[model samples]
Target: MAKTFEVNKTIKEINERIKNGKAVVVNAEEMVEIVRSKGKVEAAKEIDVVTTGTFSPMCSSGMLFNIGQEPPTMKTSQVWLNNVPCYAGIAAADAYIGATEPAEDDPLNKVYPGRFAYGGGHVIEDLIAGKTVRLKAKAYGTDCYPRKEIEKDITLKDLPNAVMLNPRNCYQNYNCAVNMTSRTIYTYMGPLKANQRNANFATAGQLSPLFNDPYLKTIGLGTRIFLAGSKGYVIGAGTQHVKNPARNERGIPLGGSGTLMIKGDLEGMDPRYFRGLSFQGYGCTASVGIGIPIPILNEEMAWYTGVSDADIQMPVKDYGYDYPNGIGRALAHVTFEELKSGEITVNGKVIPTVPLTSHVISLEIADKLKSWIQKGDFLLTEPVEEIEST
Candidate 1:
C-alpha cells in the first residue's frame, strides 16, 4: 500500500520545536491510538517525537572502572571487587567487570538451583547506590610498579572513571520459553513449568525501542537515550545483533533480533532503574531501563511507531529440549497480546504465561523521557553513523 501524503522533518527542526515548546511528543502506546485514529500521515505531521522503553534483564552488561594507581603505581594482574573476579587486562589500574561474573566461592548450580545473591551485578548496584565495595588487586612486582598486593574500599565517587558499557541490549523481540519434559527448568527467562504447564518470555512488546523503530532509521551511533536513569548514547550495533532478522508482514521481527551497544557515565545514576537480578539456577544479570526517542522524520516512522502488542509476535521454544540442544526451530508462534493476557494455547493445550520484564517500568521510562524532551531538558542528536542494516 502507498501513502496518500509524505510528512518529513529533521532532528534540528524537532529540537527547534522543543526549544520553542511546540513539539508534540508522545509515547509508543499513545502513538498507536493516535496513528489509528488520525492516520499515519496526519500523526506524522502532528507528533514530533515518539518515546519507546524496555526494562529487562540484560546479561551482556558490565562496567569499566579506573580504581586509581597504587602508592607505587602497581600494574594490576588480578583484580577482585566484592569477591567477584574482574578483568584487569585493560590498563594499569583500569578493570572491567561483567554482570554475569560470579564470585569465586559462589556455589553456582552445584546444589541445584543455586541462589546467586552476590556477583558483578550486585557490585554494580552497590556502587550506584552509594555503597562501598572492597577492592583487592595483585601484581607481579615490576621494577616501576613495586606494589605486589593491595586492598581497599571504593565507591563510585572514589573511581576516577566509571562507565557502564553494555554490549547487547534492547532486543527487538525474544523467545517465549516452555518446558516440554517432566522436569522443571530454570533459564534466563525465569522458571518454566514442566509439560508446558506455563511459559515465560521477556520484552516490553510495543513499547520496546527496536519495535518502535523496526529498522535502524532513527536510532544510530551517538543517538542519545535514557539509559538506566542516566543519559546514555548508542555506541553501535550490539554483539550478536541480527540486523535483518526475519520479519512478519508489519515489518516487526519475529524473534530475537536487532540490539544496541550503549554506554554511559556512572555518575548520578539511579539505583531503581539499575538493579541486580539473581536468576535462581542461572547466575546473575542486570535489569536495565532504556528509553529512545524517535524523531518523526517521515510518515514511515510514524507508521512504525504505531505497532501494538497484537502486531508483535514471538516464537515459542522448548527450553528443556530444543533450547538446550541448540535448536532454532520454534514449536509455535504467539502474539504479545496473548502472552500479556497471562495464557497462551499450544498444541490444543492452554498454558499460563508470565512476563519476565516489567511493563509498568517501561511505561514510566517512556514518560520520564517524554517529560525531559517536553521541558527542553533533553535534545536529540543526529547519528554519527547509521547502524548497518539490510
Candidate 2:
C-alpha cells in the first residue's frame, strides 16, 4: 500500500499535550481495537500514547541494599539476609540479593518437588511489606575499622538505601513448554506434566512492553517507567539482549528476544504489585509488575502497538528433552490466542494450557499507568540514548 500521508509527533509535543490535559492515552488492549477499526494512520493522528504492562516471574530480578556502617566500620566480606546469601563484594556495606537465590539449607529437590518456601525474593517482599528481616555479616578486623561480625534485625526504613535492579525483564517473546517424556520435569517455566498433559508459558503477549515497541524505538536508556508499583527507569538493554532476532513479517519476533534492564527505589513500593514466588522444585523468584508508555511518534508506532494476541506466534518446546539437551528446535508454533483459550495442540494431541504470568494484573497496570498520564502525574520522557537495534 502506498502511503497517502505522513504522521509525525515528538516527545516534547506529547509532553505539551499531557501538560495541557489534552493528550489521548490508551492501554495496549484498547489500542488494538482502535487500530483495527480506525487504521494506523488515523489512530496515529488521534492517539498520543499507548501503555503496556507485564506481571511475571522474572528470575533475573533482585535488590541492592546499603546497610549503614557501624560506629567502628568494617568492610563486609560475607552477608546474609533472612538466611539467604547476598553478594557483599560491592562495598563496605553494600550487598546485592538475587531473587532466585535459595536459602542455604533449603531442601531444594533433595526430595522430589521440594517446597522452596523462602529465599531472596521472599526476603525482599518482607522488607517492603514492613516486616523485620534478620541480617548477618562478617568482616575482617582492621585498624580503621575494628568490628568483626554482627547480626541485627532491620526493616526497610532502617536501611540507608534499597534499590531494585533487574538485569532482565519483559521478554519480547518466550517458549511454551511441555514435557514429552513419561516423567515430569521442573523448570523455571514451571512444572511440565508428563506426556504433554499440560503446557506452561509466560509473557503478557501483546501487552508486553517489548512487543509494543519491538525495535526499541521509543523505549531506551533513561526512559521513565512504572516498575513494581513505583516509578522507575530503563537503564539499558538487559543481559543476553538479542540485537536482531528473526521475526515474522509483521515485525513480531518468532522466538525469545529483546529484554530491558530496569531500576527503581524499593522504598514506598506497593506490596500488591510485587510477590515472592516459589516454583516448587525449581526455586524462588519474584513476580514483578512493569508498565511502560509508548509515545505514538508516527503510524509505525501506532501499528506496532495494535498487535493482537492472535497475531503473535511463539515457539513450543519440550522441556523434558529439547530445552535440557540444548536443542534449539521448536516442536510446533502456537499463538497466544490459542494459549489463552486454555488448550493447544501439541504433537497432534490436544492438551491443557496455563499461563505463568497474570494477564489480568498486566491490564490493570497498563490502566493505572494511563491514569497517571491523564492526571498529569507522569509525563513522557525522551530517552537519553536510543537503544541500538541491529
Candidate 3:
C-alpha cells in the first residue's frame, strides 16, 4: 500500500506553503544530490518543485516571416536569404527556412557533412539583432500584384509577419544514437569513431524533462518553458510522439516518450544557446536549449523529480549506416550516471562517451529559470491537456 498524497490543495494553501517556507524547491541537479543523500521518501516529503532542462538539437526548428509588403505584393516564391533557400510557396511575402537547410552552393553534404557554418537559424539570428539579411525572391507579376522580383537587405523589424514555431521539440526522452560500422560516421552527435570506439549522449544529466515527469503528469499544453534563452510554451504534442514504453519499477519510460510543439519569439533568444551544428558526413541542425519546471503536485511528482542519474537510463540505438558489414542490434542499456563518467561498456568493450550539448550551460539555464519563478517573473500553469504518450 502507498500513502495517498493529493496535489489539489487550495490555492491559498500553496501560497501559504511558499510564504511559510513549507515548500521545497531545487533545481534538478541539486535534487538528485539531495535524493541520493536522504532517499526518495525523505526528498519527496521536503521538496516542492524541481527544475529540469536540456539543450536539444531540434532540426525541425525554424521561423516564418512576412517580408516587406511592397506594392504589387505577389506570393513570395523562389526566396533566398543569405544564400539559403526558404520555403515560400505559402503566400506573398511569407516564407520559412528550416534550421538545417544548407546554402545553395553546398547542398546535401556536398561541401561539408552538415554545412553548418551558416543556415536558416543564422539568418534569424541576424534578423533579430537588426542586422541586414540579403533577401531575393521571384514572383509572377499579375495585374493585381505586379512584383516580379524583390532583392534587398531587410531587418525583422520591418517584416510584417514573424513567428517562431517548432513542430517538434523538447522530446521527453530520446535514443542514444550509436554507430556500429567500421567506417567513422558523422552525425548530429558529432563524429562516431569506428568499431564502437565512442558513444555520444545528449540530454543533460539529471536535469532532463522525462526524468522529472517520468509519467507525464505535469508537463502539458500551456506549460511555460525556457526555449533558446527565451520564454516558450508547449502548444501541443510534437511529431512522432509515442507512449507506453517498457519501464522499470520506477515507471520511467524506456524509450522516447511525449514530445512538445513549442513556440517563442526569436528576438529575445540567446545566440549561444541557439547554435547550428554539422557532422563531417551528415546534415546540419539547430542545437536548441530548453528548460521545464515540474511542480510537486503530489509526493509522486516529487519522487519522480528526485530520480538520480544512476536511475535514468537510455537504450543505445544502432543507426546501422556506419556499419554496413556488421549486423545491427538493439545493443545495451546504460545509465545517465554511467554515460556522464565518459565511458560505458558495449559488447564487452569499454568505449568513451561524448555529450553533444553542454551540461554546464544546461544547468545555468535551469538556475536562471528557477530564479525567475522565485522573483515573480515566471508562473507555473496547468496544461490545458495532459500528455499520456506518443
For model 1, the stretches where C-alpha displacement exceeds 4 angstroms are 1-5, 107-114
User: Candidate 2 deviates by what RMSD?
Assistant: 1.9
What's the CA RMSD for each of the models?
A: 1.8, 1.9, 3.2
Query: 252 in model 2: Cα distance from truth in Å?
Result: 0.6
Backbone clashes in model 2, listed as residue pairs: none
lDDT of 1 by residue, 321-368 (tens): 998899999999999999999999989999999888999999999999
Predicted candidate 3 versus true structure: per-residue lDDT over 75-156, tens digit per residue:
6678998888999888767888888887776655465554456677667666766688888899877777788998888777
- Model 2 clash count equals 0
lDDT (10s digit) by residue, model 2, range 92-155:
8899999988887666644554567688888898988999999999988788768888899999
Clashing pairs counted in every model: 0, 0, 9
